[model samples]
Target: MVLDTQIKAQLQQYLTMLEGDLVLKISAGEDKTSRDMVELVTELEKMSPRITVEHVQLERTPSFSVNKVGEDSGVVFAGLPLGHEFTSLVLALLQVSGRAPKVDEAVIKRIQAIQEPLHFETFVSLTCHNCPDVVQALNIMAVLNPNITHTMVEGGTFQDEVKAKDIMAVPTVFLNNENFAGGRMEIEDILQKLGSKSDGTEFANVEPFDVLVVGGGPAGASAAIYTARKGIRTGIVAERFGGQVNDTLSIENIIGTKVTEGPKFVASLEGHVADYDIEVMKSQRVAHISRKELVEVELENGAVLKSKAVILSTGARYRQLGVPGEEAFKNKGVAYCPHCDGPIFKGKNVAVVGGGNSGVEAAIDLAGIVNHVTLLQRGNELKADRVLQERLRSLPNVTVLTNALTQEITGTDKVNGLTYVDRVSGQEHHIELEGVFVQIGLLPNTEFLRGTIDVNAHGEIIVDKHGATSMPGVFAAGDCTDTVYKQIVISMGSGATAALGAFDYLIRHTAPTQELVGV
Candidate 1:
């Protein structure tokens, strides 16, 4: 059987939701991948009476298309859609079988309104937790709009294409055969990239909020929920809902839950937030914030929102090495998110830079996929926990270098090697490798607040015990603040503290009604 008992049982339950019959057109060859594809499709056909299969010639061998009865959905899977992509395949089957996708009505309208014919091909790895979002998003677009087509190309099953395209990252998307975007993107993100207008006027005319949270991560979600529970007008504007949490793979530190993945946890957060009467503005970036009669927060799309109080829970992002060729080689050979990009470098030599817990964990993870993992640390020793360090040391193919400072990431079209200097010996060294995974640390996403609020030397917003920042009516939390620990639980607690603090401020100091200030 292509699927295990548990998976097959689950599939059987979900297959019952299909509203109508669907067809799976298979294009196969006498290869292992093709044979697997045939077996999987045959098994799927047997599981549901609504599913039927037909052998046909397609553009790519060992591929299949999910289509409606007597109609084409333009959604194709170029490889075995197992692992993290299994959910994508299930969603495709249901959607193609006439079940409506759970998307915003406005987003569905935007997808159907596209005038241009766009063919989107997303390269993905089955093991990558982040690839399914992009794959499922494009598949939904294809299923909704006849003018759009999308194919999920598994990189492992198409090595030649991956090499030719120089795709060193998972979830790399191409629009019309041109490199479009990399990393995890939501449906709204894709629409915005296609030049969808946000209509800032809608935001400008909205009533002023009692509390506005400027992020959507764990911290921001906590703040929004805490404030909304108080029966106040709470609105959250986030560039993306999950923020750095989406890139995270396994989150075991969350209280009450033994373990959970990033996407799953984010889904719970979204569901919880949906139960409250909070306004959520997704895919919106805060450009500036100023305090007048009321604090005015300006969005990048020229939308200005006023609030009686603001909570800056904007979290931090992965810190770059700031070395030469890092930017140019990004998505080529240099990458972050080891869980997302590790499988792409299978059997290839790669290096992980950093010595802390994140770096050591990355090296340990990469050692299993890559041929070799050379961990370069700037400090004299690995700073990871004892268990992690011991696990990393047990990896035979992994090498640990202490007191090593990365100098540059060298590459032409793609990364070939990297240079580093031995901090103690003052000697430079180079390692030949195909890819580099950076897990140094994170920098706060508080650049938009510089000079307006009090930030420390590291650009972290300084907050008091109550999570109130130097600027009155403004609070900071999570990794963006000068918090000693950057744990998720800590961030959530700080978020609550900030929300309560903002509520106290709102009650004690009532703001005078005034005109909204323009950015």
Candidate 2:
């Protein structure tokens, strides 16, 4: 029953690509965890002859090992492999069969360059959809490097380890017995944390830039393209290129485009940025920024770089409800991303905060997976488009509450309920649920400025129509700024404006060459 007809068909197709036989040793038990795993692999065995499924009872050993060829090369799944973790199970099966790994070349090169061994242990549960992202990132890293050994343990069955570690969340990763990360993390972040430096030497002593952009989202991409077109020295320092855009599911309000996914739009942004001369420092974070005659930026890796003018387009992050248990239960039934963690809540009740398009869309999406969805909005009515509202109402499993303010996310270790107050009715209500998804709004990513630039009360950088900051020769744009509408196209337009403003300032004060002819 774990593997539906469609999933069984897909597994049959995938298993045929296996180069070697895979043994799945599942524990014989009536427990849900053990039975769920058994049902999954038994279905696979019926479809693919290459997959060997065995049933055994192991009181001391793990519940199951998917490449049961031994501890030398195997992954353990102590719980059912449902949700998005199903993909991880499939990939691990393919990998154990000597399949080529799908990892970034740069990452593989770093892993290949490692002198010391890296041991990674990731704890996960069957219901944690985001666990696969971390597990796969480390799994592929281990696959690329022989010295790297990785293990994925299902927290549900390993109750002793979970209790001993005081683990209340999923996707808890540890490197060398030290905490690495607990939730969704990028491979680059993992590499940097492991002290595996990028391919290039440190950025210290590097040549200064005429204009430096601090983020690599759409706003930063646009600013870089505009600055590069002006034939000026431009560079961008970013932890990631796509930013929050990568976490999005649908992007429909991009002006010319009717619709596109986050990854596609991000790829297009990268492709467009590649058309110009820009110094892109990926996986680098701006630790500090100071402005004297020149704007000096310090990176977390102790690298320093100077710029004549800087654009503050760092963008924003999803705002938390700031209620009790919101932080305590993060990744422990409290999730922000529906696309990344929705499947984990299948057949379980959950709630969504906000009446905006994102929140409503998330509710509608979750209604298809979870048993039920309760959407809370602080406003009198939904702020989403009429079509989105209509589609949301069309779903039977969704309940919308207007003018409801979330009071707290409640649970002992994981979220089990959500409390909210109705502003109009002056009454409080609580919904029993396993997960709460907050899509209320965004908080600008201008904290790194540390009061160096003028920011609004909401911590957003104040920018004029042309993206000029309070400081001369400096500019700001995108979600980091005080823009009325934080759309992708608007951010791009603001970035171009900031670049033009910078160009105008450079020509008038810094003295420009023929590059200033257009202005």
Against the unseen true structure, what C-alpha lDDT does each candidate score? 0.92, 0.79
lDDT of 2: 0.79
lDDT of each residue in 258-311, candidate 2, tens digit only: 998775688799889878888787778787888777778888767778888888
lDDT of 1 by residue, 180-221 (tens): 999999898999989986767567668999899999999999
Which residue pairs collide, candidate 1? none
* Model 1 spans > 4 angstroms off: 511-519
lDDT of residue 60 for candidate 1: 89
Q: Which portions of model 2 show Cα errors greater than 4 Å?
A: 1-140, 150-180, 192-201, 511-519
In candidate 1, position 143 carries an lDDT of 89
